[model samples]
Target: MTMAENGTDTAAPQEGEQQQIQMQILAQYIRDMSFENIVAQKGLHGGEVTPEIQVQIGLDARKRPVENQYEVILKFNIESKNKDSEDKMFLMEIEYGGIFHVAGVPEDQLHPFLLIECPRHLFPYVRRIVADATHDGGFPQLNLEPVDFVQLYRQQAAAQQQAAAQSAQA
Candidate 1:
């Protein structure tokens, strides 16, 4: 019987084998980042402005494969606005990507490594950049806490499944 038919290849390397996994930052740049310090100037001048700030965070990810290497990007956007005046005070977007050279890993383990471990490794740098940019833009530092991507992925998947089930029932 061929390896394909058995769902397990005998020639596949065992877990913890001398597999090579390399994580490299091929390119890191701000795909787009914007910051508006409308309130900063006004506040400095003692102008009448509300102190309330509204922050919105967005997350996105994409995967690219080149030969045997994989490039995954985790994009984030943060927008802060003054709720009362409906004026945007701050906006920042970052696209962080890492290229991984992974081999001798079983197919089943690849998904977790890419979606969870790889992103976890890259999050600190991304968070730092965002915080620094916001601070340098004359606004308060925007230090975002680390996220549990595994739990997030599971929650999202569960929500999707629930929605699909409800739609089917409907």
Candidate 2:
């Protein structure tokens, strides 16, 4: 057991060629983007005051017809409304997608890789889109906080397990 130059252990080849692990981004694009400033003048003035902004994040992965290829999408739904009034300030929605080539990753690691690692690679771009959309919509730049996809995935897994357990007991 010896450490490789990159700090990962490199095992001597046993009987066959070593496994290849690769994840490559073929392309990345904004699938959909919409920004609406509902109230023009009022919203602009109201925007001066702090608005209540809500953001939602979603991730999806689907296998492509091509072998070892998958499409990963990061979706965002952001809305801001006047803090003191019921009037709407602005609404923005974005869907950012990337085509990834994944190879040599085991089946057990596939789902986690797609959901956690793939999205981790795609999040910064999505965050920038949200900020730009808000700024273009005549509001102060709305910089979204960094997301913790690993924690989110764990929570989702726990919820699914609980639901399955409840169904089995029913």
The models' CA-based lDDT, in order, is 0.67, 0.86
Candidate 1 lDDT over residue span 1-170, tens digit each? 23766587657566767766655656555555555666565664434545444333333444565655766667776777655666667666667776766555567777666777767877888889878888899777877877888886677668779999999999
Candidate 2 lDDT, 121-150, residue by residue in tens: 988888888888788877789998989999
Clashing pairs in 1: none
TM-score of each: 0.64, 0.81
Which residue window of length 10 is worst by lDDT in model 1? 52-61
Candidate 2 Cα misplacement greater than 4 A, ranges: 1-20, 41-48, 165-170
- Residue 11 lDDT (model 1): 76
Q: What global local distance difference test value does model 1 have?
A: 0.67
Clashing pairs in 2: none
Estimate the overall C-alpha local distance difference test score of candidate 2: 0.86
Top-lDDT structure, candidate number: 2
